[model samples]
Target: MKPRSVRTSVTLAGGVAAVAVALAGCGDTKAGDTTSGSSKVTASPEAPGETGGSGNPTGKATPDTVPGHGKTGQTGGTAARCTAGELRAGWQRQPWSKDGHVFATLILTNRSGRPCTLAAGWATFGKGSSGRYQELRTTRAAMPGAGTTITLKPGTSAFEGVKYDATQGCPTIGGFGVKVHAGWNDVPGGSGPVVLCPDSFTAGTIQPTMNGVNFHS
Candidate 1:
């Protein structure tokens, strides 16, 4: 499991609220769009597009490559071929649904240094009803690389979301979220995924309800 970055995890619950506030801001509605501490925040709908960070997308490995620290190695079946870049970080979600399925959204960010790319792939694991742990699902997107140029400036990021729908013959999203130990095939080796929660999970905070507790399968 990635340690979690504040930028990504903290914003999970705000998704629906963001849209609500943005809608209420049309006329004389009070200033509800700004999230508590984020006084300058404005709400807007998220769009589907290629997401990532900036930097030397084609450079040496970064210092933050610790296990469960977000940047996974390319050995465990999943690979995101990041050439050489400055910084590569991602935001992910683990919120459960009404029907018992957990949804995940990975928002990749680049801090601009070199050009790089992330492959689309995923895996899931957790305990099963039989009291034994099992691999729920593993997937590889056909697209080779989601490339980004090194020219992007610092603080820029990208977003991508995929649902592990319950398919009889495929991996289900019911188990406790899997440890993101795999990387894109392009960067094969095996490392941990960078987590998206920042600060510690707290009551009423987005992290707690979104990722703090794990559901037993």
Candidate 2:
């Protein structure tokens, strides 16, 4: 097994970014996010100062069969299926984030000895507490080519670009979580709390994290 390398990243204002992990041999080894759906799910408006586990309309609850969980379109790869244990998760703030909209990338690395595949769909996730994405996050995909299975070789990585916003005078998030397989893993997002009122939040499709790829906003 390769040694787990420590990665570091630029901190967002207010220490929203916690103690970070760096990419080992990859460029900078920052955080990442994931997206899904054949088409994008528009976010619904929530009341101001509203806070609860009540996810967005397009968002699903945990233990998701949402899109890529068990669907043939999302997981038809011949490579060994990736389990939650074999992958490590992290998140990164997008360089283009601005104007109340916070974009991020979700990253999952294969730490096992063998190569495997990831479900080519929206990641099931939520913001609140560590490893407790009780609510599933929403995702939109680039269709006609979205469900192409992603193979993760040992030490390689996959990513999802997630979209969210921070409302002024709202609550703060404890952290974030996402599901690869088996169960939910933490994907720390500093996108603040409260999915209310004009706050849009949804992930983009899963893709191979290379050449500094990003899920477009």
Can you tell me which runs of candidate 2 are displaced by over 4 Å?
1-77, 137-139, 143-145, 186-199, 210-217
The whole-model lDDT of each prediction reads 0.23, 0.42
Query: How many steric overlaps are in each model, in order?
Result: 51, 21
Name the weakest run of 10 consecutive residues (lDDT summed) in model 1: 17-26
**Residues 81-133, model 1: lDDT tens digits:** 23223333333333222232323333333345543333322212222221222
Question: What root-mean-square deviation over C-alphas does model 1 reach?
Answer: 18.7
Residue-level lDDT of model 2, residues 98-205, one tens digit each, is 554555555667767887776444454444544443343343433212434677777776655555665454445544444443454333333333332232555444
TM-score of 1: 0.26
- The global Cα lDDT (0 to 1) of model 1 is 0.23
TM-scores for every predicted model? 0.26, 0.57
